[model samples]
Target chain A: MKGTFRASMAWLHTGLGLVTGWVLFAIALSGSLSVFREGISVWMRPELPTVPVQTVDATAHAVAWLTDHAAKSSAWYLAVPNHRAPYVFGTWERPDGSYIQKALNPLTGSPDGIRDTLGGEFFYRFHFELQLPYPYGRLIAAIAALALVVGLISGLIIHRRIFADFFTFRPNKGQRSWLDAHNLLGVLAFPFHLMISFTGAVTLVTMLLPWGPQAVYKQDVMAGYTDLDPALESRAASGKPGHLTAITPLLQNAEERFRGAGISQVYIYNPSDAASLVTVIAGNNGTVSTLSHSLTFDGTTGRLIREHVETRPAVRTYTFLYGLHIARFTPDVTRWLYFISGLMLTAVIGSGMRLWTVKRLRLPHHLGHVLTDRLNVGVLGGTSLAFASYFLANRLLPPMSPHRAGHEVQCVFIVWGLALVFALIRPARRAWPEMLAACALACFAIAAVSSPWTNPVTQSTALVSLLFSGAFGYAAFRALNGKAKQT
Target chain B: MESAGTLRRPLATAGKSLSLKRWDLACRILAALPGGYALAAFSGICLAVWLPGLRVERAMTGMLTGLLIWPVAFMASFAVPDGRKMLGGTVIALLALMGLAALRGWRP
Candidate 1:
């Protein structure tokens, strides 16, 4: 019975892991890249000048602009710029559901017209959304995450001696070497892998299982959310228009209230109306939880209206898990740790997929075996190549072209689609190295075009690109030399 | 050891028969998809109704725990070995949780 149980788990791990391996690889790799989304975004748009310091009252400037330009808006949001970000982002909702957003210069308060590219948002969204339509994309990502959790648990159960092979690595043994590397990466990052998947599922729980709130709140999710996180609220715009007060005072008041906590965002509800409200959300830089302490004030008079700090045990647990998954509260050093750990998990997934093909390559002529091998290269190598092309497109595309951002995304898919076609036509052994070589070239192209020596943001982008290029270049060299097949 | 090997050998041999393989695949799918999902949902509702906390908090806790429950249920779908046992165990656990949930909600 014990043998049978372990066998069943082993089968479950292999079967389900193979079925969803490609999507999991893509998700992990993209998520790893999105750790530096801000830096990547800054690199993509070089026209924006570097923000000197955090001296400007961006909240006041953004509010002043909205008072002049978007006075009729029912709701206004101001995203204060940090060290990495150069511009204050503003968004206002019309009477209808549509929203208008702009990037404003933190110093001058004028709109920054760098480019229309989606920038890093494309990779961030693709990490969880996969660019699919609406709820389906998110639902698929959640399901994939759930499958990963199942696979990991089953794997732990099957591998009886967890530490027996901890220090084992045998090169030139082909499938054995791949298996050893897979196990090594998996065991090394097991805790992170489990935590990431579990928290990822919990983060999407509201959407994945809407019934939980529906049954408890009698289908009134808004009421439930008010208790869960009450920082956000909307008020109708009064038809009677009025002048606004200076927002610097409100921001200063919020900082005082939170004991000098940095203000991350400012909100104006029904701005320029008699019944308007101003809300300032506390930053989570030093905090362990993702939920920001919020203070709402009367927009007209600048008097404190309401304050919410989530202290409930259940909500705190949720926020902690959310913070761990997103790592928004981590400092720069810890954030890089998270990024490297995320990349390690990506390597684990990729190596496991490779092991699948290497094991089946025993029967070389089998179509299923060939298909898996080609797919290993096509999906893994193709995605890496596509991401590099995305950066390349950002550099090459004309800045003023309409739908410039859309074309950048299209470039990613076009390159990826071509690689997939090439994978199908070429031998698996040949396809792997070829795609990897292309990935290496694209990485170099992005690094060269960005000219990373100028600014800190560009420097970070160049460093990451060069690192990937070196890794891919070495891997391509090994694959070309026929040494990639050894265990 | 011989008996255990014998028990496993027949399952491997059964795969050679397409019809048996198809039936086994169907059973596995049934146990994994609907069976596991129902168990998670019922257990969640049971905890949500009976657990000590505010209504939303209890629901959130129950739902998060329920998400964890799904992987166990999924693994059990295969761990049970026998297709009949897998389906039967899943239905029983799901129905039991549902009954507990109903009784908890009956106070109205």
Candidate 2:
């Protein structure tokens, strides 16, 4: 009976992992990249200066720019410049219901010469949204996260010699090597994998199971949100036009009130009206909770209106989990640790899927075996190549091209689709090494095309790309040699 | 004649048991997936309605804690060898939770 139970758990682990492994891989990989989302945004736009700027100066620049260009906008949102992101990120809602987003210069407050692109925001969105519309993508991603949770639990149960196997790695043994690698990666970063999956699922829990809120709020979702993170009472815009007060003092007041937590976001409502209000949000620099104290001020007079801080324990707990997953509060060193662990998690998923195929290849070549093997190469290899192409697209596309951001995103999907087709047409043995080689070439190209070696951010980004290039090149060589041995 | 009859009985029972096992597995899957989710949702509803706190806080706590039920329910569904018992137990627990929620003024 005990043996049967273990066998059943093994079955569950394998089946669940196989079903959700690809989507989880994509999510994990993109999530890993998103750890450096701000840096990647900076890298994508080489036109932006990397010199650090003061928060007040950046906010002033953004406010001035919005007042000049987006005066008619209902509201303007500004993300102040920080250590990671060097420029002010601003977005405003126009009267026509359109939204414009730009990275404003800290010195000049202009978007001059900056190309239009989603930058790192693309990967961040794709991490959770999966490029699908509205709730569908989020729903799918959430379900995949839940599946990952189940997979991890079952995998733990099935890995009987977990500690014993951690120190064992027999290389060049084909299937056994793949299993060992998968187990090693999974076991090495087990806590990170578990935390990430559980937190990832919890982040979207409301969407997955809305019954709790539904039962309590009964169609009043906004009320529940108000309770979770209370905001100042919103007022309608008075039609009378008024001149806006300077924002620098108001931000200083908020910073003082927050006790030097620094200001992260500023929201200006009814910018040209008498009822204009400015809301300054505290940055998540020092706290594990994303819930921060916010201060609202009268936009016309720059007088304090109200201060809001989350005090509810339950709400604080929820935000802490959410913030842990977002990792915005981490310092530079901790952020790198997050990034490395994220990559390790991705590697675990990839190797686990590869183990499934490698184990089956020794058996008679059934259709299922053939298809899984081909897809394993296509998805795992193709995504890496596609990610490399995204960077390549950013560098190669015309700076002034219309709809350039959309085109860059399209480049990713188009290359990924072509890689899939290439994998399908070619034999599995050839496809593996060929795709890895292409990935290496693309990474090398990205490093080669980067300019201005003086900037530390750009230099480090290029160095990372070169490192990836070397890794992929070595993998491609190994794959080619392994195929030669089989023949 | 008795020996021939015993042999025939074992053959028929073997054929019947194979189909029965397949049905059991199918039922177990159903219980694990959709039924497990239903159990989790109902548990969330119960917590939201019955827990003592501000309405929103109760709801948030319930939602957060309720999501954890899914994996446990999923594993539990397979841990039991009898599929019928597993499905029946899930249904009973879900109904009881819903009943408790109803008593606490929850609707829909």
True-structure lDDT of candidate 2: 0.84
- Clashes in model 2: which pairs? none
lDDT scores for all predictions? Answer: 0.77, 0.84
Per-residue lDDT tens digits for candidate 1, residues A1-487, read: 8867777777778888889889999999898888787677778777776757352376577677777777888888877877766677677887677876566766667564667666676788899899898899898888889998988887777655567547656666676667667777778778988999888887787777665565667757678877776766556666777667777877887887767557777878887788888888877767767655888888788877778887877778888888788876778897798899889989988987898777767754688878878878889999999988999999899987877878999999999999888988888788877889999999988789978478777777788889999999988888888645452
Interface RMSD of 2: 9.5
Give the poorly placed runs of model 2, Cα more than 4 Å off: A484-487, B1-20
TM-score (C-alpha, index-matched) for candidate 2? 0.94
Which 10-residue span in candidate 1 chain A carries the lowest summed lDDT?
A50-59
User: Candidate 1: what lDDT?
Assistant: 0.77
Worst ten-residue run, lDDT, model 2 chain A?
A: A225-234
Error of 2 at A252 (Å): 0.6
lDDT of 2 by residue, A1-487 (tens): 7656666677777778888999999999999999999989888998886577888988898888888888889988888888888888888997899887788888888988888888898899999999999899999999999898888887777676678657767578676667667777888888988998989998899899889889988978778776665665467899999878998888888888888678888899989999999988888867877757887889999888878887888888888889899998999898888888898889989988887777667667888868878887889999999988999899899998988989999999999999999988888998999999999999888888776666766787889889999999998998999976632
Which candidate leads in DockQ?
A: 1
